[model samples]
Target: MEESKEREKEACQELPSRRDMISNLPDSLISQMLSCLPTKEAVRTSVLSTRWKTLWLLVPSLRLASHDFPDYNSFVSFLDKSLDLYREENSCLHLELVIRKDYDDDQCCVTRWIDHVARHKVKHLDVECILVKREFLEAVPLSLYLCESLLYLRLHRVLLVGSESISLPRLKTMRLEQNVYPHEAFLQFFISSCPVLEDLSIVRKDDDNVKVLRVHSQTVTSLTLGFEPGDGHMLYHYFDREILGICIDSPRLKYLNFNDDVSKCQILSSFISSSVKVHLGGVRYMSYYSGGVVFSNQQVARSFFRCISRVKDLVISETIMKLIYFCMKVEPLPQFCDLSYLEAKVCLVDVEMLPALLESCPNLNSIVLDLTRPTIITEQITAWAVPQCLLLSLEFVEIKCCCKAELVGMKLAKYFAENSVFLKKLVLRWRGYVLEEDSVLRDLLELSWRSSTCQIEVYGPLKRPVRV
Candidate 1:
């Protein structure tokens, strides 16, 4: 029985092995197959056999993702090791490098990586340039102009080259990102040099610099531009003398969008340029930088009233209203007073502007006052008497951050009860400490007396979900 078992085992072992020897596999075939898998998986195949060993070194493309590496230095080290071990099978490379670090390191390493890929005759490259450190001090050089063989390029969170030129002869598509600047000059230079370029998308940075970014690309048939400002620092560089501006010049621009602040960048009224007129008629949507900067002076506020026609809908910041009141000294309307919709940040001075503003926007209907600081609002709104106006289309009115002594709230409720002819709904969202509570209630009740016939909803302290 032992002899028989041994013979069977020998028979099984003697059978010609079906698996192909690693050394016998064609290098080209293995390399091509490895190229299809992930970089990690491709490298893991080397453990199978010695012939498969060098196959991963032939992967034509390398991707060192940011999320995969804990830090930039680690990613750089991994990249260096991978590149050092890379074999000739990867004659031409299609590399994508995305590093999550500061722009400084990106500025330093980008050129080196680009050069490495170019040396390997890389054809497709997608890289996310980031700063590792020295974020404010360093600048990225325009060395990408040397990648002649690159076919597709995407830049994100990278420094913008003011006017440096980039020529990618084989390049077909160039997508500038949304998060950071892909400077107008750099884009212009890139497009100008890429004669055969077919597709281009510049998801523009958020800024008010209305100096149209010149894009010269007749060959670019498909263009998508997010031309408006973003949720950038509205008050950033508060002390800086230079106000940021965005100027775009793309004659053949087809798919265009200009989205305003994402509801957070309360840039106040100064960001609006009355002298500037945008003639982008066929625009898909006029979205961004719409609200305003907080005006510190009444002159600025009054000027805003004149130009309110330019803005579709406005969230009047509290500061701007104060500025208006501070500057308000019984002035007449500026000129264009066709404002229809307004969301005010209620202040005492806002009352001063309201007389003229309401008079001007005769077509005005809805007004939302967003009040954050109860004390400031109380003082601000209390300072001015209610502007008398018989609003025709007026229906909805929301008063937030209401305190008892906020004399403006009582005045507003009283005024509306007296004058808001077409008024249908009013939400009084109030908040205050113990002593001020009764005063607010009394004021609201007084306003109610004015509008026994008008519908009023009072959200008093701890009454409704009228969070300040």
Candidate 2:
């Protein structure tokens, strides 16, 4: 009877658990379910039953973030075991490691993890290793370039030091941040190898070796490049003498964004696509520098504006507006014959530059001017020939101005109301408190609208500003 009871117990254990529908599913499906969770939670499946014990090992993706581990040694041990146990022939891997202290042992462990992923067929990889030290630059493992199966790769704060040509034929999207390439030419060499790459983003810090960054990708349709202050470097480092120029030579490029101090860099682009959208900014430096530094940026400003002359939509930041103000004094401004939409950020000093810019954009349909200063000398409105947009094409005018009094607001409203002939709508946004609000409204209403169809909308301190 005891022997019979033992046989029944064995049979009951082999049967599926009560009310369990998923556990009895095929091994491949179970592994697929486990792969979606973090590696820590995925490992918990081993306790479910004997069949599920080894299923976590077959998960097709391994994600190990440093914060998931209680301590560094636990993180190191967990990564070692996961990679060793990962039985899937082709697995996708993602790692987000934060190195608060610069330690060589942690870096070596990262190298080992990268090596293991490269040997396996890693299809999609995203690794972000943040080196918290001010002077440390993390070295990316060379095996990363050998992973031909990688479809998307995004790396941050990693140094690419080798002279080897990085060939990843299937990569479609790539992002590199604070990556130290040995030379500027290495940046081009790395990009040229990816034949079908579609999207690329590069954020560079002050590099000792890279004087000029020339992005020459034929396949990239979208690109975003920015330069900002690094850990030990101040914002002034962006305008240092060591960094010289940026050249963009992509013929198929349709969209571009440039965020940096224009004072120090020369920008040159090959215009193949006549219509592109461009945002040029990083003008905050103007408030701090001496007059001599501002004077030197005139040529730099001219080069940038000339490059974007072919764009249809243009947004110029306050810094860029100041640059143009300086450039206009030196050279004849380039005409933006194709430009339709114009948004400009201007201070009291830059307001003088507007008529010239507006004259250049003969076909501008809508204009949004963001006034940076709270007050302007309305009496000193420099004379300008009537702009082509004011007479014919311009239908809408939006002004974002800040003021302590209503009179300061009236000066800008009166300028546009008097000029725009075919204007359909006039919108004025007052950012701060406007004293004598009703009088300001009456004054705006009293201003003569050039077009009979023009509608006036004014928002004061009590109301939220309208979107331009």
Candidate 3:
């Protein structure tokens, strides 16, 4: 038996080795594959064989993070050598470079690299420079605004100083997060220069030096505006410097996501499309009087709602729901004549307001409720006037319990099951820790649904099987 085993091992060793199929692929395909990897890891492929030695330099994209290296000097050296080789050997048709790091060593290093890439006709560039101290922010080179080859650009925690003649003709998507612009006109000019821009996202800080942001692009299709509160000592002065408002004039706009607590108002106009989708959250008004903060002013809230009343899809946050509930006391919500889909995040105690909000969307077809933060039920659920959509257009209803199961959520579910006339599917999802899982299922199963053919689907915790 030992002699037979030895003969078999010898025969296997005598067989030819397997071919390296991956290495045999075309250099263009191999470089494209390496482009998906980090620049450091891509460069390490050089040691694989002589064929791969110079292949990484041909990669169309480079993602460099300073933390990936032991020190800043090594990172700089690698960038210098790699980019030099790429410029000499590879075609400049497309190049993407992403740099994310805290560059405190030499501020000029970042600007120099950006200018170099801009000159080389970079197609995509993402730079996120985190500062150790928030007092000083590095400014992007003026040359970047003139890179006509750029298609996508994302900058975070940088200062954008506009030039007299800013030109990025091919730019399609741009994101500016926590960036500092010199003034409001500079920002408007910066955005107007991108003639073919389609998507734009801006995350404002408390002291971004822009009071009233105006977006006046005729070609933009999607826009997202959000706010980030200051930290530590800056929080003490937050209430003193709230943003006045935002004005948008994009005629081709299809989507808008507005999430800002500081902005007092939002004005949207020139919307030619009636099928716009809107996501609203953290919109409120706070007044500082007698050394205390008070939230009031329903007029601002009402105006905000009216601006988005024509949207086809609406997603409202819990804070905005509370504001709407209070605003309803002073004035009624505008009719959402075109709204068909609604997704709302509400607390259990605030579920009573859901029907009133739904009544405004007369043509609603689907509703998704994200229920959370349950409070003790002390009073009966308020009787709501039946919404027009519930009787005619409502078809799909989904209730997601983001927290532990509660009687209020079940009651809301029961209310929908019995009220929605044309409902086709009712979904109930909850966590597994609730001891009343079986009881909840029994109650739902026994309820008399308004729709004769309504289908009920129950989902428990992911660890457990689905209970129909």
In terms of TM-score, the best-performing candidate is 3
Cα lDDT tens digits, model 1, 43-82, are: 7787876667667886678866866777667777878777
RMSD of each: 11.5, 6.6, 3.8
Q: Identify the superior model by lDDT, candidate 1 or candidate 2.
A: 2
Residue 205 CA displacement from its true place in model 1, Å? 11
The Cα local distance difference test for each model comes to 0.54, 0.72, 0.76
User: Candidate 2 residues 201-316, lDDT tens each?
Assistant: 87776763577888888888887777745667665554454536888878788777777766666775555355667777664665325645447656666676777788888888
What is the TM-score of candidate 3? 0.86
Off by over 4 Å in 2: 1-71, 93-99, 102-106, 132-136, 163-165, 229-231, 234-238, 283-288, 291-294, 329-332, 373-385, 401-410, 430-443, 455-468
Maximum-lDDT candidate: 3
lDDT measured at residue 385 in model 2 versus the true structure, 0 to 100: 57
lDDT of 3: 0.76
lDDT of 3 by residue, 1-468 (tens): 999999999878765333456888898899889878877788999998898898888876777777778777777787778677776335333434444445545434667777778888888888876643445566789899889889999888878876798999999999998888889899999998899999999988767788778898988999999877543435446545543577788888988888865225555343534677888877443332214323455676677778778888888888777677777766679998888899998877777777778878899999998887867653455365678898999999888886664556677778888888999988777774563556667888888888888877767765343356
Q: Could you estimate the TM-score for every candidate?
A: 0.48, 0.79, 0.86
